[model samples]
Target chain A: MSYKDKKVITIGVVRDLTGLSERQIRYYEERKLIFPERTPGGSRKYSFADVELLVEIANKIEDGVQTHEIRKEMLRAQKKQNQEDVRRKMIQGQLNAQFGLRKGPTS
Target chain B: MSYKDKKVITIGVVRDLTGLSERQIRYYEERKLIFPERTPGGSRKYSFADVELLVEIANKIEDGVQTHEIRKEMLRAQKKQNQEDVRRKMIQGQLNAQFGLRKGPTS
Candidate 1:
């Protein structure tokens, strides 16, 4: 499927991918750990990145880390990733300017 | 200090390294999630790798993964890392042999 048209995964698909139980997944949602979208029928739909994050979370808990600490670290990691993305975009913009591409107005 | 002679860190050290409370670290030990060495005085001592694992575990929980599921994934990841290490060693041995080093007995 085209990137935009790729289907969002159901809760069952997420469970299978992450090897987590439905109850556990729902518990995570209740904890506000993940915020999957919902269908009009009230079923949850997870993005692929969400499933990957679940896998990463599973890996962390197995190592004897506490839940609250894990939440903090995940947020930190996400913020770091965002910063890296911004840096990459800035570098790309510089290269584009060198190549005579008119700089679009900075967002 | 050489790697082998580096002092084993006490439970307090581990707590600081992992950003976990003493009670939480003890609870993890009770769950058999970690097996730190004990001092003659009955205090827990953690290796650097053990503390690193604790950090990894904390990261996972923050991502909303369940504890048991995290445990399973951690084991899988550990096994994969071990296999990769073995493969690297084998490749290194092959390269050494090509450089005129005699093949050592296989472990």
Candidate 2:
């Protein structure tokens, strides 16, 4: 599907995808955990990314991690992953250099 | 240091490691988010795993995931990761089979 036309899932859809109850999802919204866009009729619409994030949040909770703590951990993990991605790109660049496709010593 | 004697950290230590206030950590415990071991003197003793979990929980909260929701999301993420790891192992096994290092015909 085109990016803009990609389905904007309803709250029920998000609940099903994340295996969370409607009440729980609403409660999370109230806590500013997720801010799904609202339709003109005031219906919540979630994106696929939102559903994935909800799943991640659910996993942390099942591990007995606290909500606030989970927030911090998610941010840290995201940052760490970003850094790792950059490092991987650097390594790939080095590999390319070995084939004389790029010019640079390993960083 | 040996595992057992590696040091059972105090609540203060946990707070420092998790960047959470003592009250917040205690609140999480009351909510059954985390259950650190207790000392004979009724002091809370956190393990390294507890610290790591706390860090993860903190990340979720910062990401705007709710407490109860975070619990569910964390659980789901953990299951997903476990499943992914198993899938990766299976793929690895298939690769090994291609080299006659395993006894399977690509299941």
- Best TM-score among the predictions, by candidate number: 1
Question: On a 0 to 100 scale, what is the lDDT of residue A84 in model 2?
Answer: 100
| Residue-level lDDT tens digits of model 1 in B2-107 | 3222225556546655788888778766766667876555766565567767777777778986668767887798899999999999998888878855657756
* Each prediction's whole-model lDDT (CA): 0.68, 0.70
Candidate 1's displacement at residue A66, Å, is 2.5
TM-score of chain B of each: 0.68, 0.62
lDDT of 1 by residue, A13-102 (tens): 566557899887787677666778766567776655667667777777789866677788878988999999999999988888788556
Q: Estimated TM-score per prediction?
A: 0.42, 0.36
